[model samples]
Target chain A: MKNEDKDLTRRKTIGWILRAGIGAVIAAIVVKTSRRSSGGRLVWQIDPRKCIQCGKCETACVLQQSAVKCVHGIQMCGYCKLCFGYFKPDAPRLDEAAENQICPTGALIRKFIEPPYFEYTVDEDLCTGCGLCVKGCTNFGNGSLYLQVRHDICVNCNACRIAEVCPSDAFVQVPENDPYLLKELLPRET
Target chain B: MRSNILENCMLNIGYWILAAVAMAAPLTLTAASRFPQPEFDSGYVAHKMPHPAPDFAVTPMMDILILVVALCIAVVLVRKVRSRNWILFFGLICLGWFGFIRNGCFCPIGTIQNVALSLFTGVRLPLVMGLFFAVPLIFSLLSGRVFCSVICPLGALQELFIVKPLRMPKSLDATLRIIPLIVLSVGIVCAVNGAGFIICRTDPFVGIFRQSAALPMLLTGMGVLLVGTVVARPYCRYFCPYGVLLEICSLISWKQVELTSNECINCRLCVGMCPVDAIEAPRPALSDKVRGRQFKQFLYLLVFLPIIILAGAGVGHLAGAGVAQLHPGVMLVEKWQSVEEHDEDLFPSIEAFKRSGGTIEQAKMQAAEIVGRFREGCMYSGVFIGLILGLRLLVLSKLQGRKVHQASRSRCVACGRCFSVCPNK
Candidate 1:
């Protein structure tokens, strides 16, 4: 009986020592890692310059409807009479026709401002983010139309599925306070 | 007429210069004006870009508060209340909050990778993520694996599916338990080297909680839940990397759930009542000769430990080379090479690389560097695994006499089911 008591006490003391050791290790890790930590929440964003518009964003997201949507930088738009982002490259006419529209979903709305200038707006609800319009705009006109992760829709998965399959490696984590990485915006600012 | 032709030629030259500048410097041109916007006769103004705010229903602070409260309640219920029904009710609440409401983001299971990556790389661990990783471990050290019993949503989800528990063969159970340790080693290795978060990628429950996933992943989640009906918390038992840490902490916990408040009556009612089969039956004291044999076996294992570790390292070095192919840089280089060899039209990544002005040689060098890191990490992981296996064998060979039926310190999740079965209360 005396031997059992001594054994139990020895085991308890050993447990205490291990507990203290583990606690110290955890504290050290916290101190070391916190010094370098970015100290804010991060959300995934697509770098427009790197994005090759591989069309994976539409399919790879965990959401039923992808969070990625085309966002236009109006400042960068040329407001061309024949907008490559709006009309198909081989369109029979420049008029607003379903056959002549570049966007598969017709999410791009073209509004006439004057004789030769037109305005383009994206319908976020209808935009599938296939990047077909982005491809056309970047290749032929002022590359104003680009894809951005819609923060409101994005659940912000811990490791984004789209990021894993992104051909351009365009997906990057930005501070949640300023999430959009749109064209005409400097990368460093975000 | 001569002056008119000169003016037209000058205008064409100006347009050419503007187009060349636009093509060469897209970003700078965008920052300025690529093609000058036509002066608006109607005075129509361009709208400012609208940035939508992210919806955070339960903020990080709220998540931490709930986690702490659930853990505290779990400890009390398991230790003081000792009611399986209360634990079940509380676990359901945690499941709803952490699983469906939060969509399983920022979980302690996935936080292992974040902590690891932060430790080894420049990737900064968020404060909330660091806290999420550490708090459960701290609680486990203090009061056993109360976190597993009622706080972890993944475990709770599995617990809900348990219909009729089946007893696994002892040998099979022991063998399967090694998988979590192996997973922990590989997960840490991959995360530290910035490969990927294998834990989050392989999580079977996250898809179900979010109600969206690839077909394969959704099927996997369903399959785990279905098997859970009979097996009871199979993922927690054989797969969870975080559980490996919790097991270690709980092994040396300050306090753990006791089977009874009174003396043991040697009744076997509580035996096999544990859903997880954590109860160990009482054993007669071992003979001196058997102890001597075990001591001999221990010494033999000690002698062979280094050999085992070296063999493991050799296998791991080979497997690491294969695993390195999964790295994006390595995969990109391989794809580029294939495209070059076949004279194929440029793929998206290859085109992106060309646009970025990166040479193939530079890409190869980068891939080589990543592959080297993988090899080193896998070799170290192999050594660690081998050491764990060796130690486990040595411990198993050691003879320890027990006189009472009690919960296994490392295996028991402190669910308090055994307490209810004990008539001594």
Candidate 2:
């Protein structure tokens, strides 16, 4: 009986020690794994330069509506009313209306300047991917508006659905390594 | 019985710890080095699918090959096939191709997990974590613990730790099953809640299997593995969310590894030998018709196919675009580009550009382009989600014996005829 008790005690002690060791190991791995800094592996990547910002992403996407929304690049704007990006080649009238306004969201807020000159700004919260504004800007004004994949919500599938349907073919598949493919512009352009 | 139970409990714990330690060592080294890229990972811009870390992937492939060879040998042990030549052919492939090189570069499970975690949590856990979760679950479900039988590094490590095999109390073993479920549930909840990936933080098996990341909770995972070595794959048996999924999948899995009843001669050796308790004691044979119908019933879960697709589309729509908010890595990109910092200037110029249509040479055109592409991507995401869910359901449904007779199973008997002639059999 005494021998049996000693054996049992030995097993119990060993078990406890083993359990402690396991705990330490798992802690170590989690600590190690979490610390690794590999970059994101996003499937839907955009080239800011290639994007004409036609806003096809808003309409052509397979979602019920569209997940594409408008975003801004603040550094490069002159903000003029004959705003090459927003206005038609020849305007019947300059007043804001469904026909005159390039943006579907009425997201563009115009500030008055001298006659025939106005500054416009985008209400990002309201801007959808309907590229009415982008098309207007690129064709008539500076090509400021461009499309991008909002990494926050992108599913990043192996094969991107938008890439297949894109009329412009602007999308490209980024490698699992160094996922982001942000657009680069010349110093003068920015 | 008491002594056996005691020994089983001790051994089980030992095995768990051993496996956990083995898995953890490499991962810890990685963590200390700021999680350096695996040697095989191609850092080229074109390679978007994350590669599995070398330590985790390479070791397991070898182990799996070894197991396949052993099983083939066992197959020869039980059944005498008239086409002995075919057996040699199969043995070579099983030992060479499948055993050595897993054909697929990225395991499906890993991709699914990465996408899922990115959606739910705001962080992109290392792509390896996703694969780590996937490999075992895929193998166990499709091939019946073939992963456990052969290629899992943690499993192999635990075998070394286990000094003795002892009978454990069924009640205790049964109770431990809850661990994996709890772990899985917590992981999912944490992921969805945007709290963090519990799997990454507390994955006990990964510590022993792969070196992916470094989180504070790895210590706990290691402890769990050490305990498992003596106890017999406590993670697989009780705590792996992927394991639970594999268990559900095994219900309809077409392929299974087992000993034939005819050749068994009532020997119970295999039963005791199974480390994870996956084997079932042979029961009285049920009528083929009943078995067929039961199989058909299992397949009925596929009807929800369209619903799954629609749900994904609908949810994708509601979730809105801009995956950056949901994934920290994307957020990092936003930071790198300074999107939020210059919001005031960026918004107006882009807005003006959209208003103008490139008459101006300002940054507005760039902004306009970005907005346009993002919208389209969102739409495609919805469609893709819908299609995937629909197809998954369809496949699950189709698996349910849609036809009264199957080409694979319609043979003369559960006979060794096809088994003998087949290369993969």
Candidate 3:
């Protein structure tokens, strides 16, 4: 009977020690995550330059129309009348005909700017991040159009599909402040 | 030079400390880092060199809290708490919180791939992630698989749906048990070779958590959940790659998690209680001659381990070429440069490359980089699988005469079901 009592006591002590170890690990996890989690709520976004015009942002996202939207740099645009982004590459004319658009969704809206230049702006709701217009512009004209994660629509899935399938790996977790990487003037190379 | 060394050490320490805190939250702990290039666009025409330190991603600190609570709950269930219903109720709560609320992102099961990736690819591992991956395995070694029995949400969810547990024959169970080993080997090989986390991509329960997945995956999850109503944690027994580590640890465990809190009465009441068919009936004593022959057979198999490992390596090398397609780089190369793998209307990866104007040369370079990693990793994974097979066979051949029905230490999940059936209670 004495031996049984002693065995029971030893088992209890061992259990207590195990419990203490678990407590310590839990405390460590709490301390670490809490300390790291204070700065700001950062969410996934695409860096325009790193984007390789992968249309995956449109299709891969769990959301029906992807949270990724095309953002045009207003300042970078030469505002050409024959906007490569607006008209298909082999279009008969530079005119804004619905049939001549390269964008499957026709999200790019053309506007009258100067005599030979026309400004193109993205329709945020219609922009599906298909990257067709961005591809066209980057390939032919000044690379003004780029994709960005629209925070309002993005669920910010822990694993961003665009990031996963991205050939260039352009997607990043950017702070909510300074969300968009806008266009800026550059020193042209001679 | 001394000062430089000290400074570098300090920086490294500080970086790790901060990284530990970052890993505390269950953000996607993917093996590879996202946003490879810091540049926004190649032709921004701005001062792009001085890229600001991107804001630290601050997700909810709920995952850490849940994990800690899970540990507490497992202890409570095992040591203090007596009621099985209460344990099931707690499992339901965990299923809701960890599964649906958190959406199962930083699952320890999936972290096996990340751990493997960090080992091979020099990916920086966060301290919290290392702890998360190690804790369950350690628990299994020191005590038993408390993690599988109670902690993991994936298992917890399955526990809730276990309405009528069925048993399978011992041979079939042994055959199915090898699957987790295969998955672990394949998962590690693909992850190390830059194929990304195939385990996470193909995770059966993730669909249940997200409330949204591809139709086929969602249906598969639903089907599994439905089957779980009768089969009792089929995935846990057969498919979970993470279970392989826990199973190994449990096999060599010092502390045993038996069926009862006290001595089992040998009443055979607890015989069919184990949901995953982990309990074994008392075996009649084997004659000395039969036991001697079995021992001899075991010795013969032991001598063949090296040959088995070499054969496994050979098979693994052959599979590496096929597995390389999991990497987008390899797929891109095959679609454009090699042009031998497919005859489709263009897979999404190829279509993405086309829009980006990616060249075949670039694809070839990417393919070579990925395939090169596989040349080393895949062969090792195969040898590991062979080692596992050899050891399992050796263990199977060993005969220990038994007088009492026993819980297979490696297979038992320690869910405390048989505890309720003890007549001593």
Candidate 4:
């Protein structure tokens, strides 16, 4: 091949390399940035200061079932037999009968804590968004159980459907720019 | 000589003006949404524009007719480049301009449907839904690829950037063709699943020409355009789903962008010149006796067509089933299908379940059926696209390869080789 032809080929080859390289770089940036930011250490949590954990989260979500699972604040519980969070005020029986217990998934296990005292801990897997337990606890006893948005499932539509219908309007459009919403219980005063 | 140049210049100038007018008028009038919003430091979110179809009475028929007219004009131009026909090309160009610019949309094939669906369905915000799928198919049936040749913003932009052209190897071009099909298949799968429109999301060229300032998409668009300067319409040739539609349409087209000004001499001047590598040398015409023998074998083509279609569809159906089997969403939907007597009257009442504190695992199981059906839809679309491309290749192989031609089909990048090569020009 002639010298001129060789030079042209060299130029074209360089051009192709530059183009391909640039395309790859741009694609890499987009795929990296648009992710839900699970990499951050702070997970989505319920703010104890803000949460009333009303059963409304259970009803208004667009998902076939709401994914707002109830979380427990173990430190706040007094372990009373008449645990306000566990039983409805109109309960006919105090024993662990299905109708008497407010927890639907039977996630909250109630254990006897001496005379007139009971303690409660939550089993994460079976908890559904019925919020009956949350309503029982917050209304009659110290508000410990609360509803929180699980980032894993929330589609995070630009306008959250739940936020619109929320009676408490508890749902907030947290910035994807800074993703975590906390539900931590501060250390109780000794 | 001056008069001839003047006429050609006049034609070119007229088309340019029509293109501008076609683009601007629609944008001003209808104000359709700008897609893949350009990003900048100011953080300007793309302002959502109302659907323009209502204002102009846009319909699939209008898109189809305009494409047909455009095809007619293109055919006439190659067959006989007259001043009057040039006028027709201008008119068609104007329609394309009106369709896009005035309407403030890209490729009206699907835009009209999007508007209608938004006004009527009250569901998902479709990026490019409804009529888009139908518009291209109808035009492909009536005339050759009208959308790809002109009017497509990407195509129009490509026309400007292709200042120089170089030949790509046949092996390379064939390899590149595979990429577009893969992209089209992926896009279809994503769309069917209601995930997102991959075509709009991943469009690199649209970003570059339109100055999509969105850093990520804009950067991608720039990357593609820069490649075009060297490779020539890389997006259209290798990736555009619209291109796939056009290729299928070209097969049945009464009008073709012809290679030769007169009879094929096998000189191959046109082959090297085509930037998109469209032109090829004609095969040796059979003598009457040879032709008679070929005619005897023509019945086989009819038999093959149905066989190909059935095989394609069957394969597509099975693949779709396979995807449905794997997706969690499909499985979830299946569980809910039998239970019709629900509060909301929908199989998977997501809201009701959310209230109950449901897990993703549960939703996945319940929504599985919906997911499966969508996969099945996507698989069929993929198989059909594959069959069309296969048929195109089969027909293309029968023609004479442009081996000895000065410009082979693979070598030509539609760089206007024959325009200057023409003795008439």
TM-score of chain A of each: 0.92, 0.60, 0.84, 0.62
lDDT of each: 0.82, 0.44, 0.69, 0.50
Docking class of 3: incorrect
Which residue ranges in model 3 land beyond 4 Å of their true spot?
A1-45, A72-126, A140-142, A150-160, A171-190, B1-62, B284-291, B337-375
Candidate 2 RMSD to the real structure: 26.8
Write the candidate numbers in order of decreasing lDDT: 1, 3, 4, 2
C-alpha lDDT (0 to 100) for residue B135 of candidate 1? 89
| Candidate number that wins on DockQ, 1 or 4 | 1
lDDT of 1 by residue, B1-425 (tens): 77656754654464456446556774544433456767788988989568797776866667678899889999999988998899999999998988888888879998888788888875676677777888899999998999998988899899889889899998999899888877887888777766677888989989888888888898998999999999989999999999988988888889987888788777988776888998888887789999899889889999999988987787778778787886877888998887754453357766666667787898899899988888888888788778877777777774788888888778898877888888998
Return whichever of 2 and 4 wins on TM-score: 4
lDDT of 2 by residue, B1-425 (tens): 78656754654464345335534655224211222122222232212212121122334334344444554453443244433344334434443333233322223322333445555444544444444444444443334444432333333334444444355676776456545544554444334433234454344434223232234335665666567666665555555555555554443343454344234444455445444444444444456777676566655545555566567556544443343243332333343356554463344333333344443333434433443433443444555545643543444322222211121211011112223433333
Fraction of true A-B contacts recovered by candidate 1: 0.46
Model 3 steric clash pairs:
A49-B40, A49-B41, A81-A117
Say which candidate scores most in DockQ: 1
Candidate 2 stretches with Cα past 4 Å from truth are A1-174, A177-190, B1-112, B115-142, B205-218, B260-262, B282-425
Task: Quote the positional error of residue B194 for candidate 2 in Å.
Answer: 2.7
Residue-level error in angstroms, candidate 1, position B375: 1.3
Prediction 3 global C-alpha lDDT = 0.69
Model 4 - which docking category? incorrect
lDDT of 4 at B396: 42
lDDT, candidate 3, at A18: 57
